[model samples]
Target: MRVLRYLVLAGLVATAGTAVAAPVTYKLDPGHTMVLFSWNHFGFSNPTANLGQVDGTLVYDEKDPSKATVEATLPLSGLDTFVPKLDEHLKSSDFFDAAKYPNVTFKSTKVTPAGKGKLKVTGDLTVHGVTKPVTLDVTLNKVGPHPMMKAQTIGFDATATIKRSDFGVGAYVPNVSDEIKIRITTEAHDASAEKK
Candidate 1:
């Protein structure tokens, strides 16, 4: 009976060890979370551009794989294609129409952990009154305390190739690349717990 009791206690301790979770949260470091998009104008030439001001949160469970999720919003008015005159034109009804639909938001419905620190994030992407299924190819670059802010944060690089025309940004299609490559360099920390 003594031996059996010892074995049961050992098993319970092992189970408790696995249940302890690592601190994980990703607060969008707006200064570091860059939303960039690019397309080919004619042939192989790819013109790249970036948008400013993306806000969001990324929650990760290092021990429990099923509990991870992401939520973010990108302002449509912030989209910049590098040309100042063209930028103004883009905000009109012919394109993003910032006056009407001002923001693009994403909320994750599923997160699957792939080996090599990658995530297959399936989520709803809402743009211009249209909500569609979008998946972000997320690679967890690093997860730890921030050197500058001194808070726990996770760094990731994500990409999603989407069609602007699908969201009714259909003005200059065929002439412009139908496939837009969107890239994000994201650093996330917990909003309530982060110092900076």
Candidate 2:
């Protein structure tokens, strides 16, 4: 009886340890997330654009960071260049062709610790109906209760560079610039906590 009791207690302790390391899923807060991009315009200036409508889910486990995964979607129609005409032109067939390929998406393939509060995220990014692998240098901004919403939230800032020509969005490649820089800032709330 004594041996059996010890075995049961050991089993319970092991289960508790697994539970503590389980990953938690967080729902992206569109209001607090922004996807911004910049490209060299005719070797003159680097112009920027932002995607307004973004949504995603992130599963993260601080205890086992390798288990983290993220999937996000951005509507191409929401691209804003701060100029109405330029935004319209970007959505036309000459650029993103938003009428047909309406959304851009990314799904993380691997997450590795790069340093303190930083991660190297490799993912597949689909833009203009072309899919390619990209890596983002990500920094963890914060992870705790949000001051405004009083909810558990996690924030991150990530950046990546991609060549537009590889994605089939190359119009005037050498002139308009083939390389685009993307920066993303996102805050996600714990979906389970939000229900309460």
Candidate 3:
């Protein structure tokens, strides 16, 4: 009963008096969101991969985007490069060692407006048990009506780059690229609907 009441109170805070209320929270739809990363292969071409099951929440205030925040968590063992054998090897102790560290996460501390709907989100990115401050260049794509989903939606694209060595994931180092580039395309479903 208490949980149900709290849920209702949250919904109330999310929607005060608007047809399309500004979302106090946006739940990440993993099916609609993507997490991608790329690294140089032994000083050669860049190898790209899709990390699986990134889930999180986003709190947004359009009128005051500075109040916006995003949090994401990805299972480290779910790393993939389309090759089963390679994926397994990467998850072993030689590389990411998913056994020891099973997840990587990011929690935004601040969202500063950079330009028109663009923001520089400063956050702590934890990787392989190492935490470091990182900055993500985020672009708010759009937020409004969605004819297909029958719900308000928010879209954003973000990018951040970091050195693998800094996070203690340094195995290949100079042989392969130490720099890892992370890209995220978020499609969040706003359930903060109309409030009376």
Write down the TM-score of every candidate. 0.83, 0.88, 0.85
Q: Lowest summed-lDDT stretch of 10 residues in model 1?
A: 16-25
Which ranking of candidates, highest TM-score first? Answer: 2, 3, 1
Whole-model Cα lDDT of every candidate shown, in order? 0.81, 0.92, 0.84
Q: For model 3, state the Cα shift of residue 27 in Å.
A: 0.6
Which parts of model 3 are misplaced by more than 4 Å?
1-23, 192-196
Clashing pairs in 1: 26-188, 26-189, 27-188, 27-189
**What's model 1's lDDT at 39?**
83
lDDT of 2: 0.92
**Which pairs of residues collide in candidate 3?**
none
* Tens digit per residue, CA lDDT, model 2, 1-196: 9999999999999998896567879999988888999999888899999998888899999787878999999998778899999999999999899999999999999999999999999999999999999999999998877888887789999999999999999998899989999999999998887888
Give the per-residue lDDT of model 3 (tens digit) for 1-196: 9999999998886776553445467778788777898999877688788777888888888778998988989997668799888788888887888899888899999889999979999999888889999999999999876778776778999898989899898897888888999898878877455221
Can you list the residue pairs that collide in candidate 2? none
Higher-TM-score candidate among 1 and 2?
2
lDDT tens digits by residue: candidate 1, 1-196: 9999999999999986664455356678888878888888768578877777888887787776567888889887677877887778767888778899998889999988877788888999887778888998988898766788777677899899999888778777888877889898878875656655
For residue 56, model 3's alpha carbon misses the true position, in angstroms, by 0.2
Model 1 quality (TM-score): 0.83
Query: lDDT-based ranking, best first?
Result: 2, 3, 1
Off by over 4 Å in 2: 1-21
State candidate 3's TM-score.
0.85
